[model samples]
Target: MAKLDLRGVRKSYGTVEVIKGIDLTVDHGEFCVFVGPSGCGKSTLLRMIAGLESITGGEVAIGEEVVNAIPAADRGLAMVFQSYALYPHMTVRQNLSFGLENIQTPKPQIREKVEAVAKMLQIDMLLDRRPKDLSGGQRQRVAIGRAVVREPNIFLFDEPLSNLDAELRVDMRGEIAALHKRLGNTMVYVTHDQVEAMTMADKIAVLRLGELEQFGRPLDLFNNPANLFVAGFIGSPKMNFLQGRTDADDRNRLILDTGDTIDLPEGRFTQAPGQTVTLGLRPTELQPDPDGALHAHVGAVEQLGSESYLYGTFQNETPVTVHNPGQTTIRPGDKVALTAKSTAMHLFDTETGLTLRG
Candidate 1:
């Protein structure tokens, strides 16, 4: 396995720059995922690494060598595309053996490699089936198997599970994570889904509009986001941002435009008296309370067996979501007060969206 390094990597379509200078590294055996919303340059960055797209500037290093000039075929990287790009006419076994055959590998060697990869991917029983006859999930396994049979230094997956149904997507996610575990090869995955990145990546690079917003462990980005964009994008149900300003009279209170005042923790937030600040509250951290300090109007309620999610809006009609454990009697149109879990509040500068810490 080889580590991958990207130094000031950039790509542009004529005068339009898509990839801003991005410096990231995926160590040997590390699973790094590029996660962002669509059109955020995640796919463009992946193609740059694969040598499929020319770099506007900067360098790409696989292991110790700069591969900026290397052809994609010689890069020793196996890629699994979102479309499950398999030859429709070829059976599973034939498809798995195609890459090795193109390299003129011995017939016996190709047979052995295909058999091993098929079994590893649990597609051994489906070897005789053509892509036309296989399910979406099965076809995905074959595409992955084709990559595995080649045994490249690194694996690149471009939204490999996007076409699957919800249940199959979850199943395939586990399978891919397990494949990475057993093979221990460096992997770079591109997905717009933050949940997938959180579950599978050793490191995550969060991108926005071609800029690398933040790069770190999944939890690191979740717990202490570098900026408001990362905070809002990394979590499910998403973090709620309420526009407010630090109260000049009460240093520990944040006065919201919605006519609510949220208490700030002592020694944890800076003094930005009277200046507009963004208050971030996680849904999971907000709980219903009778005498809670903040008020919200419930709009909708989602009952997920073990837990409940409530969608609401504050007095100013700013949307907010709250995750409460177990079922709740709270219904739509109900007004509720919420108490934030201790130290769960996030404060950001209103203008810059940068986190405010003591």
Candidate 2:
């Protein structure tokens, strides 16, 4: 196992920079995930760590050794890609042992390693099958097995489960998480899926454009986002935003565009009266109340067995969503009042898109 570190890491295509200065560290045996939207430089950052991309300026170290000049082959890291880059002609066992053979490993050691990895990944029965004959999930396991036999200091995965079906993806996620526990090797994964990052990572690095937005544990980013972008991007179904202004009569009160007023403790906000701000509320935070602060005109309902999600608009036509546990009888065109505790609310500055702590 090894620790991975990046300091002022950067990359650029001529004048257009893709990765601005980024500094992060992945502790030994830690599962670190780089998560962001498409074209957000997550993959580019991963490649730089893998030594597949040249670093424009900065340092990348593995186990206290700076490897900015090291070749990918000599970096002592194995990578599993989204494409399941398996040799079609080789059988599963052969594919797993091919890398060992290239380095002239003893035949007996190669066989032993292949057998162990195959069994560990539960792909022992498919050893004789070719990539063309294996299912997508099976092929992915084989690709991962190929990397495992290498016994590298670090493991890097680039959207390795994106190709699988929804059911298979969930199954593979568990398998991968188990594999991490068993091997206890430092792993760095890059994906656009927030769910994967939230579920698998010991720590998540949220990226946007070319900058690192926030880096912390999943729940930390979820409960207390540093900026508006992190708050909106971290949660599923996303957090809802309402435009409002500080009340002239009371600085601690905010008046929503819909004419609803929310009272806060004295000196809760530093913003003066009439200053525009945004109130962020998660779907789960909003509940149906007879005298709720906000009223919604339901537009759609999504029933998912154990839970239901209501999509609607406020009196000012501002869109909102509410997550209701279990079955919901609420239907389209129904008017409902929603309320949330002030403790569950998040406030942001309208001009800077930054969180307002006080």
Candidate 3:
């Protein structure tokens, strides 16, 4: 296991800068996940660390050595690409042994390494089967096993489960997490799926348009997002944002665009009156309240077995989503009252799109 450090790292494609200066640290054996939407530069950053992409500036260090100019093969890191990248004509055993063979590892040591990794990955029975004979998940395991045989100081995965079916994706996700626990190897995984990052990472680094937005534990980023973008990006079903205008002084409150007043606790707004702002409320935080003051017209309801998501608009057509237990009979055009606690609310400066508190 090795600690990884990125200091003022950057990358560019000619005049277009894709990765701005980013500084990050991964402790020994820590599973760090880089997550963001498409075009967010997560993969670019990962490839830079693996030495596959030349760093335009700054430095990358693994353990205690600077590896900015090191070749990918000599960096002691193995990357599992999104495509699996297995040799179609080679058996799982041959694929696992290929890297060792390339470096002229002893024949006995190569065989021993292949057997040990195959057994550890529980693919011992499929060792002789070529890539074409394996299922997608099995092929992915073979790719991972190939990495394992290298005994790399660090492992990098780039959306390795994106091609699999939903069920297979879940299964493979568990396998990856378990593999990390069993091997205790330092790993960096890049994914656009927030759920995968939430479940698998010891720490998550969120990036947007070449900038590091937030870095923290999964739940910490979910619970207390540093800004509006991080808030909207980290959670499933996403958070709802309502445009509002600050109404008064001494006591702060936002009058929703729908002409409904959302009362805030004292001192909630430090911005000037009439300042445009956004009020953020998570779906789970918005619930049906029989006697609540706020009412909305239902637009649609989606039942996902365990829970329901209700989408609707206020009388003024301001959109909102309400999370409900089980399934809901609330159909389109139905009028319903909903309420949310002030503690569940998040405030943001509309102009800057930055969170505002204290």
TM-score of each: 0.98, 0.97, 0.96
RMSD after Cα superposition, model 2: 1.4
Candidate 3 accuracy as TM-score: 0.96
Per-candidate Cα lDDT values, in order, are: 0.93, 0.92, 0.90
For residue 349, model 2's alpha carbon misses the true position, in angstroms, by 1.2
Give the top-scoring candidate (lDDT): 1
- The true-versus-predicted C-alpha distance at residue 205 of model 1, in Å, is 0.5
Give candidates' CA RMSD values in order.
Answer: 1.0, 1.4, 1.5
Give a tens-digit lDDT track for model 2, residues 253-354: 889997788775555446777788888899999998989878889999999989999999988999998999998999998999988777778888999988
Per-structure clash totals for the candidates:
0, 0, 0
Q: Please write out the lDDT profile of model 1 over residues 1-358, one tens digit for every residue.
A: 4999999999989899999999998999999999999999999999999999999999999999999999999999999999999999999999999999999999999999999999988999999999999999999999999999999999999999999999999999999999999999999999999999999999999999999999999999998898899999999989988898888987778888989887899889785678788888999999999988889999999999899999989999999999999999999999999998758888888788888866
Ranking by lDDT: 1, 2, 3
Clashing pairs in 2: none
Residue pairs with backbone atoms closer than 3 Å in model 1 (clashes): none
1 versus 3: better lDDT goes to: 1
